[model samples]
Target: MASGCEKGEKVQVGKSDLEEKILETATELFAEHGYVKASVRDIAKLVKGSNSCLYVCFKNKDEILFRIITDVGSDLLNELNKVISKHDDPVECLQDMIFTQILFSIGAAKKMKIYLEEQYQLPPSLKEKALDQHRQLYDLYYNKICEIEKQGLLYQKIDKVVMTFGIFSNINWVYRWLNPIGRLSVEEVALQITDMLLRSVLKNSPLST
Candidate 1:
């Protein structure tokens, strides 16, 4: 298997069953132990495979982490794109964006945990690539803020950049405290958070009044 790739080239590796198991196990271990502490052998042990067997699917631990982070980021962008395509109203788009993001945060909590906590551990080249995906995600929110502003629905006092990050701040930490068996279902939490965020930004939100 190809373990190394040129700078700026996408890291490609097999996605066979064992590959997924390795990735999944790695995600859990990285989230629990921190990236620096989670060894490739630890991941292989969890997957019930040897280190060489793990290498057949991924080049190394860094590649495994890269794949996990980038895959989650890509999956998020795709879902956000779908939300954008389905909503005509910028407010609606922004609402669904918040809702979708919160849901994703909770649903992919472990992977999101690794994304939040371990991304800086990636090598410079791979780190840049990962950050690029994040920038794209950020821009998606920024663009929607722009759309809302153009329509004069956005609060005049709100800074687009600040608001964008504020939305991220609101949703990004949801995984830490949200309980799956809690009284509120995931959708309920998402909607309530979405409403709170929208109220802060929209000039005419019902909650804003």
Candidate 2:
């Protein structure tokens, strides 16, 4: 584990693989129970470790939640970049961007759950990083919207800033109620949300027709 776990991009992570294992377990545990209710022991038990072993891998439970939040955002941004790169037209990029975000958020429900519901568990240092990542996603959406409007592919009347945030807030908020086993599939929900946003905003635009 030493050779494998020590290769983190940042720190010389001791038992890094075990740390990820513990984090995966704790993410699910905290997502279901919230940070206050879930314990380090539960996470340790999930990973077949003692409490002290868990602490050696992670400073505390708050650090676990912080890691979960940032990891989820990292996963989300990676997917978003991959999906958006498939298109060249700014309008298609914007539309595809919406779909990309919806799919990532719904598919990565546990991570989304931790980020949206359990971020308060993070210490101030990690909390700021998580919030910064969240804000960057917001800025990316706004910049995309501005680019599309400037290209005349989007309705000029649209308040690109507010519309950008509105579109993101509406779509990204789906993780809160999304169920992996629920009536709607992830793709289905993405379609529904995308359609709603399009009809509301794109409906008034010339390019939409």
Q: Which candidate is the best by lDDT?
A: 1
* lDDT, candidate 1, at 128: 99
In candidate 2, how many Å is residue 29 off?
0.8
**Considering summed lDDT, which 10 consecutive residues are worst modelled in model 1?**
2-11
Q: Cα lDDT of all candidates, in order? A: 0.87, 0.73
Every model's TM-score: 0.90, 0.83
Candidate 2, 60-154: lDDT as tens digits:
77777877888888888887777668877766676677888888877777788778877776778888888999888887777777676666556
**Candidate 2 ranges with C-alpha deviation above 4 Å:** 1-14, 156-158, 181-183, 203-209
**Candidate 1 wrong stretches, greater than 4 Å:** 1-15, 206-209
lDDT of 2: 0.73
